[model samples]
Target: MDVVVGRVAKAHGIRGELAVDVRTDSPEARFALGSVLAAKLRDGTSRDLTVAAARYHSGRLLVRFEEVLTRDVAELLRGTLLLGSTDALPPTDDPDEFYDHQLEGLAAELADGTRIGTVKEIVHGPGGELLVLVREDGSEALVPFVRQIVPTVDVAGGRVVVDPPEGLLDAD
Candidate 1:
């Protein structure tokens, strides 16, 4: 399965190298030479790109593709999503860890069978990951990643059951 690892932030220097806003545990460790990446371009097409070189510079992942060779080419790739196969990723050392890819589109519910919403996205912040849940009507809710709230996460069943406190989901 393709897992989103990063996004092409902007063009680095005059070269075709891209500065990626990494969203992984070890950014430098994820994108290695010869690694194949699927880039989701702005035109809604996916391109298979071979990693020529990947390194860390100025708190960002500097990535160069085999065919991308100029600022113009790299600029076109800006906002493009860098995706890699889950098999290529190293196993997580943390037991409680969950990948962002696994959380996307999962059903959100309560233990009592109250269907809350579907996970639209996971937002990483100072506290932790905030689950962005989108209801059927297109309204969104931000649920804290606390155990008291999100008591269960069933990736296999594609669901995350939450037990939100009073006024939690009640908030606009």
Candidate 2:
């Protein structure tokens, strides 16, 4: 149930602080001071780190881990993924909103109940987040994660209803 909440952007300062590119919508809660996080490094190793300090600088999140006490160590953490469990995160107050973890693996069907595929992963990009759908033929489709495109998300029922517009599902 470990979900990636952030990625190490780069070393912030000489004092082991790290600039983080937050992936989760709730960065304040996910990267709070004194919060412990589990991480998987690029080399396939794992470590548990405690958030020694966290601050915002010009709207960017800066964090310092107690274990990473030097700028060199922090620099090595670039591209590292910070993990948090879903149970520890605050519940979503907006009923229409759903976390990325909740959408992964859900069956995606059309409005007329056509079984298109299942959600493989969520791709976060500059434009917005997209739902990666894998079909039975093993082809993939990137569906925009918007209310107009993805109207319904039934997490409890394990299904997502998509309303794709013309040419949306076409392969380019």
Candidate 3:
């Protein structure tokens, strides 16, 4: 699995620098200096870029790629999606923590082992993250990704045990 770490927001300076809107929780680890990254374009094109420099200005991240040396070249990557392979991703220090990519596609089941659906996506919002499950009926169920509701995430087992309140799944 390849996770989206950031996106090229806009060209920053004439020196080929660009501003990136970070999507990962650990920017320092994901966007490490001198690290090479994979960029995916909208037209199904892929490119490898090396991080020439990375820094935080104000709140957002400012990055410079070795391949992008001019504003025009940087402008061409404005909407490019930055990706990081899970194979190279180091495990988190916290045992219970899991990345979004890891949670995706896991089977969602009730506490009694009754299967509900497969987790399709994880949506972030003001409250928190919601697990989007594609049910067998071709419908979708939004299950909150909180620890209380989702008590167990067995990544190796390829399943998540959800203890949702009554009517939440039926209503969906």
Candidate 4:
């Protein structure tokens, strides 16, 4: 279960540093020094890369890979997805906390137990996280991943109880 930790946004400098668009919540652990990440390139090839160094610059994550020593080589890595295994991640201890993978694919249902849709993915934005749902009608719905609307998450049961407000699920 390889999860995307980040994507190479662009080459940051002449020293092969890459500006990365982080996807994971635990970027510190995922992009730690000496960490090995699988870089899935846009062309469908994958390569193992060792983290030489990582830093934050102007609110963006900058990373240098041991294999990428030139700016040209780093530029080639643009849009490459950096993957980390789920096996390396520890389970969350907080009852309210869950990894995005855990919520994705879960059945979404109303409080009354009427199934409405399936969770497509979790979108992390500057405002907040949103649950992208594939509704029964094949339309998509964005539900704010907040406690007020999503009251129950049964990971073992493979379902989530949604208490969406009026028109929240209505198709546009």
Candidate 5:
């Protein structure tokens, strides 16, 4: 399966260029020209495309895909998600570390096995990143992404043991 890296925000001009909201810091490495992309359309349909050109402009990624030569067609591709297959991805080469994909479905727990919630989202915050915990009432808690706060992650067990700061869990 391909991991999502960015979303096509809108068409740049009448040149088939698309403005992308990037989710990865290494945009140049990932969205370079001639690279292949497995994109998910707005309707949840997926397709394979080849990147013809790409450049950074005004903090947005301007990209052109092969066969997407018209602004109208590019407009229609708005809100599409660009992804890369896991098999094509280079190894992380990090031990005792986890990627966002590994953290997605892990259950949030306390030291004593007290369940807090489920990992719903991993959002990049101003200070760092935050782990969103979805509760039964549809409410959620934004747990700080820190080693001390989130000490353990058991992907096989499908849970994460968190040691939240004082009043952090109570706020939710």
Candidate 6:
């Protein structure tokens, strides 16, 4: 499985440096020097890009790939999705921690085991992580992925126990 680690936001300066919007929690490891990432371009083709240099500037990650050496080349890479193989990822040591892929497609239910939905995906934003659920009615619900709301996650059992507050799962 290929997981998105970053997206090319734009070309930076006159060099081949690219400003990237990080999607992975471990950006340092994912964008480290010598790391090779699969770039899924807008044209549906994929290419391997080797990280030549990387740096943090003003809270954004700037990366220069070995295959790119000019601003024009970097500009062409804008909006490219940088992917890393899931097999290269190390398992999380913390019991409470989980990869987005692990939570997706799991059965979402209440504490009483009443099935409500299936986890569609995990949305990571500035506020926090949200559990996007595809409800029984085909509508979607965004549940905050905090310990208070999602009290239980049984990856092996293939389910998540959601303890949502009133009106949280209500249809508009």
Write out the backbone clash pairs for model 1.
Answer: none
Poorest lDDT segment (10 consecutive residues) of candidate 1: 22-31
Question: 1-172 in candidate 6: lDDT tens per residue?
Answer: 9888899999999989999998777788889899999999999999999999999999889999999999999999999999998788789999999987788899999999999999998877789999999999999999999999999999999999999999999889
Q: Which candidate would rank higher by lDDT, 3 or 6?
A: 6
* Residue range 36-114, candidate 4, lDDT tens digits: 9999999999999999999999989999999999999999999999999989888899999998778889999999899
Question: Model 6 lDDT vs. the true structure?
Answer: 0.93
The best candidate by lDDT is 6
Q: Residue 126 of candidate 1: its Cα lDDT?
A: 54
Across 55-126, the per-residue lDDT of candidate 3 in tens digits comes to: 988677899988999999999998999998777777788868888888888999999999989998777655
What Cα-based lDDT does every candidate model obtain?
0.84, 0.89, 0.87, 0.92, 0.81, 0.93
Model 4 earns a TM-score of: 0.91
Candidate 2, 152: how far from true, in Å?
1.2
TM per candidate: 0.81, 0.85, 0.78, 0.91, 0.81, 0.88
Q: Which should have the higher TM-score, number 5 or number 6?
A: 6
lDDT of 3: 0.87
Where model 2 places Cα greater than 4 Å from the true spot, the runs are 56-60, 123-128
Error of 6 at 18 (Å): 1.7
List model 5 lDDT by residue over 120-149, tens digit each. 867754487789899656688999978899
Highest TM-score scorer: 4
Model 4 alpha-carbon drift over 4 Å, by segment: none
| Candidate RMSDs in order | 2.6, 2.3, 2.9, 1.5, 2.5, 1.9
